[model samples]
Target: MWLLKKLSPDFKTIADFRKDNRGAIKRVCREFVLLCKKRDLFGGELVGIDGSKFKAVNSKKKNFNEAKLLCDIYSVLFLMI
Candidate 1:
């Protein structure tokens, strides 16, 4: 527990930080990945980006694809609120 606590930050801190610098952080990450691609860092590689996150109440079989994912996650979060 001690090690985990030491290595990981609380969710509030992470959330606050992300909210403050979300756009800048995303721009920097995108630039970094573009640089890597230009430099052939992932030579002949097929990259797949899935930004979907499954909610707790949603079954695994139903949680495929971006459109369905957004609906499921938002529905659960809205219900919680």
Candidate 2:
């Protein structure tokens, strides 16, 4: 087929290209998602957040704070004596 003048790339070349531009690919994906959302493709509200490291729990209000950290440190020090 006479689609273009450039020759077809081999598997290794394709793989290396992907490995080198992974971040760019992810950003492009995010932009595509935003464009789709602007076009009202999500049907309802769409919240795109990268929360892989966060855990959803009932004790969210009791999460880490300076007072809690200091209390834990004091308790551990008292236990060691």
Q: Pick the candidate with the highest lDDT.
A: 2
What's the true lDDT of residue 24 in model 2? Answer: 99
| CA lDDT for candidate 1 | 0.87
Estimate the TM-score of every prediction: 0.45, 0.46
Instruction: Name the 10 consecutive residues with the lowest summed lDDT in model 1.
Output: 54-63
User: 1-81 in candidate 2: lDDT tens per residue?
Assistant: 367566788899999999999999999999998999899888786568885786656575767889889999999999999
Backbone clashes for every candidate come to 0, 0
What RMSD value applies to candidate 2? 12.6
Show where candidate 1 strays beyond 4 Å. 1-8, 49-81
lDDT of 1 by residue, 1-81 (tens): 686876877899999999999999999999998999899887776767899885666567855889878988999999999
